[model samples]
Target: EAGVAQSPRYKIIEKRQSVAFWCNPISGHATLYWYQQILGQGPKLLIQFQNNGVVDDSQLPKDRFSAERLKGVDSTLKIQPAKLEDSAVYLCASSLRQGQGFYEQYFGPGTRLTVT
Candidate 1:
């Protein structure tokens, strides 16, 4: 099976600017998720999708961050008017099911973003 794929392993942007990251989940998987990991903290789920429908997005910052998984195969996350606190690793993961304890997910290497 193919592993998760992410782009531009690292990025540096000035505060208040916008940045976007892309992800391609493994084939045959039905669920995809985007997570943010701040330094010294565990990954926090930003959004989760089951196929083409959104399963959860409670943790996503509506004012500055947005994400979408169109067509249920790939996804993208964007941070606009970036802030210094937004510097962290953005990870993409995929699984075979939606329930929390049902499926194991595979994670990407993650995109590290730095704000200046």
Candidate 2:
């Protein structure tokens, strides 16, 4: 099986600029997630979606970041007026299920965003 896919593996933008990232999860997966990995730290969950509905987003900076999984297969995350703190690797992951048992999440290579 192939892994999840993400676009624009690298991006450099000025602070306060807006950016969007695209992701396509593995086939048959019912849950998808977005994460932000800052330098020298573990990835932090930004949001999770189960079949196009949000499952959790408490960690997401709602005022600047937004994400959606319209059809449960693909998703997009957007940041408006991005901040310097937003400079990090944006990751996308997916699993066959969520909330019941342990499920392995397949992750993408991630999009590295640099806020200048």
Candidate 3:
């Protein structure tokens, strides 16, 4: 199967500006996730979606970040008034349901955002 796809492989934006990233998951996948990975650290789960409904977003910064998967096939993440601390690689991943839980995830190349 094809992997997840993300647009704007790299982006440069000023602090306090707004940016949006898009992701299209593989066909037939039931779960999608967005992650933020900073230099020298593990990827942090920002939000998760099962179909068009959000499954988890405890780690997401609700004040400045928002995401949605309206039709369960494609998703978008946006950051308003971006911060310097927000500079990182934003990753999109998807997985197929296997038995009781989701299976191995397939990841996209990610959108590298540099907040200036």
Candidate 4:
């Protein structure tokens, strides 16, 4: 099976600028996720989608970040007026449901964003 995919592997922007990131999950996966990993910290769940519908986004900053997976296959995340603290590696992950449980998630290479 293929792994999750993300683009614009690296981005450099000044604070207050806007940037967007894209993700494509592996085939047959039923659940997708977006996470932000700051340097020296563990990855933080930003949003989760279950087949084109949102399943969780309690940690997403509504005023600065947004994401969507409307087609159930691909998704996008955007940050407007980004802050310096927002510099981090944005990761995309996907997982499959097994029997009545869930499989471990597969992660993409991630896009590294640096805000100056």
Measured by TM-score, how close is model 2 to the native structure? 0.98
Candidate 2, pairs of clashing residues: none
Better of 1 and 2 by TM-score: 2
Model 1 over residues 2-112: C-alpha lDDT tens digits?
799999799999999999999999998989999999999999999999998899999999999988888989999999989999999999999988886668999999999
Which candidate achieves the best TM-score against the true structure?
A: 2
lDDT of 2 by residue, 69-96 (tens): 8877999999999999999999999999
Index of the highest-lDDT prediction: 2
Per-residue alpha-carbon lDDT of candidate 3 for residues 1-116, written as tens digits (9 for 90 to 100): 67899998999999999999999999999899999999899999999999998989999999999999999899999999899999999999998852446388889999999999
Query: How many backbone clashes does every candidate have?
Result: 0, 0, 0, 0
Kindly report which residue stretches of model 2 are placed more than 4 angstroms away from their true locations once superposed: none
Please list the C-alpha lDDT of all candidates, in the order they appear: 0.94, 0.95, 0.94, 0.93
Roughly what TM-score does model 1 have, to 2 decimal places?
A: 0.96
Off by over 4 Å in 1: none
Instruction: Output the lDDT of residue 64, model 2.
Output: 94
Local accuracy of candidate 4 as per-residue lDDT tens digits, 1-116: 77899998999999999999999999988788999999999999999888988888999999999999988998999999899999999999998842334479899999999999
- Per-prediction TM-score: 0.96, 0.98, 0.95, 0.94
Error of 1 at 11 (Å): 0.5
In angstroms, give how far residue 62 of model 1 lies from its true place: 0.6
TM-score pick, better of 1 and 3? 1
Q: To one decimal, what is the Cα RMSD in angstroms of model 4 from the true structure?
A: 1.7
